[model samples]
Target chain A: MKESLVIQANNLSKKYRLGTIGMTSLREDLSRWWTRSKNGIPKHGFDQAGIDPTRMINDHEFWALHDLNFEITRGEVVGLIGANGSGKSTLLKILSRITEPSEGKVKVKGKVASLLEVGTGFHPELTGRENVFVNGAILGMTRREVDKKFDEIVDFAGVADFIDTPIKRYSSGMTVRLGFAVAAHLEPDILIVDEVLAVGDLRFQNRCINQMKSIAESGKTVLFVSHQMATVENLCKSAFLLNMGQIIYSGKTSDVIKKYREDMEESANLPISQRMIREGSGKCKLSGIEFRNDQNKVVDSLISGKSATIKLFFDIYEEITAPMSLSLGISNSTHVRIAHLCMKTFGKWILPTSQKSFQVNLSLSKLELNQGKYYVTSFLDDESGQIIDWVTDAFVINVLQSDFYGTGMVPPTSQSIFLMDHSFSF
Target chain B: MQKQSITVLKPSAGWTGFDFAGIWQYRDLLYLLVRRDFLAQYKQTILGPAWFVLQPLFLTVVFTLIFGKFAQIPTEGLPPLLFYNSGLIIWSYFSHCFTGNASVFTANAGIYQKVYYPRLINPLANCVSGLLGFSVQALFFVGYFCVYKIFIPTASHFEMTSAMLTIPLLIPLVASLGLGMGLWMSVLTAKYRDFNQITGFLAQALMYATPIIYPLSEVPEQYRFWASLNPMASVVESFRFALLGKGSFSFHLLCYSTIVAVLLLLSGIYFFKRTERRVVDYL
Candidate 1:
């Protein structure tokens, strides 16, 4: 290994069986063995078109990580960003040695501690003080190290009052703080963190960010995985964007996040009728969705704190016999629903109609959403709670910061996902 | 600022690869886990740690009534309290080791899937923590033996023999047998889950096969060979013969039990290592 290189991977890959988790039923394994014994190992199924024989271990094999390669030097904080099931977790698991790669290997010249989750080994029955030592040991600290850091850890978590209390009696926030404190104090040469910073209040989150910064600055390599693009852009100097088990982009954080946003928008831009992921009886379907400004001009992205109208087009497959309602929910990039718009909440309902196609325009006087990527999920339901059509991530909207209060001051998106209208007279 | 240890991760290690040094490096974790088990076992209960002593004490009384007084099973002419308490405490230690370690994977799946350590640390902790509970019961056994000595003065057969020196050897033998079987059970149960049901009743079923309630001499000569093959049968008998100086013990039997125990332990570790690598994926 080079002196400065901390982590090096060459064509690392992980293959998983499609239906089976770890091991299949004994019957299936026995039959496969019997067949192999009779024919001395079956050849790859060559008749299938467009199937890479190298990628397919067998019929059930799904290559979760397909020849992924990356290198991180000491003192570099590299962010791993991807959509769900994009092999981000699989790659981290491989790096942390929680699971082994299916092919190839990764060599790391340092102690690597992975915080896959904050409280990976905390026992509810154990007191906060007891759990601290246990969690520290699990995170790879010696007893003497934990003993020296015990007071600091307790003070950082702010659980000194309840240090003797069982963790089961702790508030969720307190538990998260204690767990994070133990992990944050771990003195490893390389740290792998999953989205643990997403928890806690704003102040705690800032403290965690600072802690992570200190770790990175101490000449330790840090591999951070999160869907929070803003956090990635703020923290990491370089990042890797993974898609379908392959590194699609690896460069500066901003460019990678931009590429990731572009991919999301591209997927959302696909015509509604052509999309495959939807849940409903299919009596009606979403045809198109359009975002327009107050001037009636169609906009590519919605402006924060500006009047906007959303036009939803629906194609009815069967004649409606009951009242219907449309619920439009806007969620942040992390897929947490932050705002909801419902026809029923406004005392409006779609009466029974026989039209083949119709469009409803819902207007928002002022879009209070923060500046970030937001997804629109639409649900069309009848009065009896029967879903006619439900589509997750029906549309993607990029909210741009605007001077809503006319003071030319706007809070960054990190503060919160939505802006509230209020007056403070302290 | 010493050089950091480099770790190379491959797809899998050899099946028989045992990480003895790795397990040793994680000794603090093993200690903490053992402490956690010991401290957490009796919490929220009225009697607390006293249950560790009382559990075997109550079982001995029940066995003294059911098997000794009513059923009149031969105890080699020793007091029922001494015969039953000695066997129960020794067997309790083994059962604790077995049952505790048998669920090592399932019980710690939450932590096991997230972190990488010597997975052997869990079962090893189980074995070590079992000693704490065993020690308490051992003290209780000593108390009972002293009481019998004072009250039943005519029972000369209860005197300690030179065979009692074998205890230092017997404890590890029983513990290894339990740990070996438990490791095997953990591996099998990690995937299939059907083996879990078997492990639930296995200790109780194996207890009858061992001489926990009766002497090995009581086992008819025709079935004695088969019973001695249990590995634990000779261990419990030797334990009784050591303390009570009445139950039968032979050098050959102890050697046979050690051979079987060692084999089970080595093979158990082999399979345990093989399964632990991929066990998290299943969980």
Candidate 2:
């Protein structure tokens, strides 16, 4: 353990059963208990030496987190960046005492508070005024402490006028403001925030970020988790980049972010339909997807300022009496939707009901995105906005380094999402 | 001046995580949980908290009809209203406390998942707030006692004495038993949720087995030992005796039940702390 460390950890791990709670009967649960006690968990992933994908995994168990170690010193701002289910939430849970680590220990020498999300304890039925008390209590604030900071919290949330209104009636943004305000005002020696910035509009996001910066500046040890690489790079001095429940990189935030992007790009070459995680109503299915150039050539990489085309192939099993629109969204690595194209807005005809497979092509006159890798999400919905199918992060596409203005200044991905046409007259 | 410091042990600390000081530190949370449960139960209803009293009061009437009027079950010569209402008072409290504590984990899963606190605070609050609800039923029972006192016009109807002072003793006896049994059931229910249905059924069936519907003397000699196995049987019996100076009394049985209650409570706390570290993930 380092001398200034507030948290020290050894080989921390956690295991989870395959079946969800209550889905298994008592007899099956007892059997799982037997298997667990007997150490019958199958050696999967990193636990096994060689990559054996077909080794008949019979243990019905998986490790959400494996042997990984890190230390956090007092007043250190550490960032955890990983894809979905990369064990980021599990790590935070173990740190916050919401779950136990199966294989190791963590010694924390401070009063810790984990802001799981905005409104972690807010009751919809409680008025904003009363919820102030209840949410404050849930966050480990004494009533007197809440009373002392009551005015500041209200003013920070900007809900003084509707303080007595039931939180259920408060707009979603209002509730988040109040929730974040209460959490920021608390005086915990250690704070852990997870994915809270992903919510709310950009203005509120900036306000929350400023509030967090002040918390960090006040000499509190903070562990923050977010998918926003830009935010993480701006805030954290040290960071841990995890993949498949193991710490692949740890050090300066910029280096960790690079490691994360490289890991994402490693799997970029697979035909997305084979690699992407698919989930939705499945009323219709994304049978195939491809990106194309103006020459009508299917490709995976695009150059900025080119006329790009997105082609989606779908299979409709059932008859559609009304028109069903398709939507395509492109998001950068930050998990924020950068651009959206809906079929309804683009195509004006009410297509008749039919049961068949079809291909819809969308052509963009100019792809203005900066040089970066982006993922595609597709959605199909009926005229009434009933989602027939949605495949989030269904495909990965690379936007290559091209001079959009015919000048040599090929803007980097970090410059901006947009590359504008410009002339230098000076 | 020396500065105070705090330390958080990792989850794998296991048994060393036992800290009564932690529970004491979160006393306000316990109070808030109790207040929330009590108030939230009665809100939005036209009758509100009155149902707390009207519930047992009405049940007492029905019991008086079935056991007292129809069956003519001897109440050891005490007026039936006084006898039945006395049992109802304690039974209502115990069952209420027991049912709430038994499901405390699943019911407050939302709060527990997000925040870290001494999990025992939930059940402890349920027990205390249950007492408050019982006090209301106790008021209604006193009303029943007054009505019987006027109608029967006999010392046999009811009389207060030093025996009544044992009430303070009787309450925790019944409450601790409920808390103990309920906490034990909560742990079991967390792993095997079928224990939840069993807990519900047994809580109801327990009233029947506790001599609430029949006097302890009438339980047929052969079944007496098994019937008295219910710790609450003595708790309710003694509560009646303390109030009306009637019904059976045995110091040894009280001692036995008290020992059983304390053992269950300690073990319940022990297992609950053991499960607290991992149960949230399962939920």
Candidate 3:
């Protein structure tokens, strides 16, 4: 059977009032009324109040989302992707009826349950069993319905033994498990989930993913909001990329992801000197970084499964009596941690030394990473677990596609990290 | 996939429609909230729900000392203890619902911003849950009334009337009025935030405006019109009149208050729905 349109949002918009002294105080409220009336600008739609954030004048409104239009048929799993503060949350809030759109509207079929953040209505003081009932009610489940799914929810959360314990006494992981379990069992016709699913232990996340997959497969219309591209690619067939409160692109997940990557690369390809936006004590700074090929030549990129060295150049401003360790984290375009290596794991430490300048070269004999642009984040940590300096996105390195086994079986971008080669002949 | 085709959500048109049905749909949530508020109220305190009883008992004693003995305030020839206790219970119920409803949005900002249910559920829950606290305090008043009647037979003229039936009826009236006003303040407080503090002071002022301490007979004829204009003034007067059999009770004023309560409730809900969408950005 062909799918029918279950959700259609037309020219939907949500405007947010912003300013430091905004939305609070009677004075701000009066002034907002004043400015809104004097200007006679439709606060909805594309208002001219969206000045550059840096050049912001206090007491001005901004359209968080504007002129967004999309349609989803029954059983369609759609991904809504955006950079931070791209109005993803606002859009979901509007769709979920938590907030109304300042302009336009969204038409949805049947009941819609949105998990903008899982466990929203959970009470810490309430027992897990009590919260399960209360939280289920918040998600629009009847008491009898919750009763039917009660044991399954507890078993799914793996908290049956502690179901009667107060959620405050339960570990945060346990609270999150119960929360996610209840949310997963919500049998709504339309499901809208935000980025909160990225939390919880990895095993729990995997279980949630399986639950979401089963729910999506059962012909429920779903709209998923996430920044994690891999999760979106795995779950959504169609995707929308929101930038600056606008739906700039809407198409297949692959093409939208490609556009998103280009956007990330554009933002990240700033001059190296200016890209050292990091946070830590001023005791050390990553002055420069260099990537070297196996032939001892400095290069911007290295071939996959080939030998390379990552040299981090730093300047120590002050002498320290405590031990220090150098750590490197490699992350993908979606900011997923691909791998982490620290010299302290190998019992190597930089003792209290008066060396003003230092360089640590990490040699990789066989870099099994697949083709993708990766970011290097370097950290200098003191013995007492204080960060001397930590530079996030300190440098960018691109790994080139290559046939590591000399066979044409190169891993695709979907599963593009650390795949070992093996073969069995019978 | 489902039978229903579409439901369009937009900025509501005209006077915001009250979703009484929506509140009914979320009745279970409302029940849980009432339970949570009634129970979670005195978690850390050693004297837990007993304080609900003690607070009114202590207040009744103090009011008896100051108003009955010191000020010699006339309770329309009724026993001062019975008179003041009657007004105090009703006053406290209104104040609880009124002030608590005012802070509803701010207190539940954590959950309100993250979830979607009928926004009315919050205030409705507070109004309903406040009864639990009132019930405990009312029990104390009953016992105190019994003791006063048994101890001082000459000072009391206790007689039961069909009007006493209004006592049960008063709960929903006071609750609806307070909830209506609270709903109004809920949105105002959410936007201004400073109103959260002001509502407490407002409640105190309103208590004076109502006949909690003094009887309506003392308002003086010239000022009675202004005093009776307050919607709750009639609710308090009628309640005392129904129970104690002696206080200024006008049939027309009761009708006036009933009309005002209905209007306040509808308008309060109207304003609440309008502000619900607007305040989220600020919150």
The number of the candidate with the highest DockQ is 1
* Full candidate order by DockQ, most accurate first: 1, 3, 2
Compared to the true structure, candidate 1 yields what TM-score?
0.82
**For model 3, what is the error of residue A117's alpha carbon versus the real structure, in angstroms, after optimal superposition?**
1.2
Which regions in candidate 3 have their CA more than 4 angstroms from the true location? A1-3, A20-22, A27-59, A270-330, A333-335, A338-373, A376-426, B42-48
Candidate 1 per-residue C-alpha lDDT over A107-190 given as tens digits, one digit per residue, 9 for 90 to 100: 988788999999878889989989999999998888999999999999999999999999999999999999999999998888
TM-score of each: 0.82, 0.82, 0.78
The fnat scores of all predictions, in order, read 0.65, 0.39, 0.66
Provide DockQ values for all models, in the order shown. 0.50, 0.38, 0.47
Tens digit per residue, CA lDDT, model 2, A1-426? 555788887888777654455433588767767877789763322222111122214444566777878788989999998865578998998888888787877878668889887677677766798778777777888888889999999999999999988788899989989998899899988899997887778988898898889899888999999878888887889999876677889999988988877766665545544543343444556778778997889887887899989887877655666677777788987656788877667565337446577778778898888888787777777777776666656677688878788767666667698777776796
What is the lDDT, from 0 to 100, of the residue A192 in candidate 3? 93
Q: List model 3 lDDT by residue over B1-283, tens digit each.
A: 2377567878776685677788899999899888877656776679988888878778888999999999998878887778888888888899888888897777878777888898888888888778988888777777877787788888768644567777787788888889888888987887777787889899999998888899888989999899999988988888777777777667788778878888888898888887776666667
Clash counts for the predictions, in order: 0, 0, 0
* Model 2 Cα shift for residue A235 (angstroms): 2.5
For model 3 chain A, the run of ten residues with the poorest summed lDDT: A42-51
Write down the lDDT of every candidate, Cα atoms only.
0.85, 0.78, 0.80
Candidate 1 Cα misplacement greater than 4 A, ranges: A21-58, A271-374, A377-394, A397-426
Model 2's DockQ? 0.38
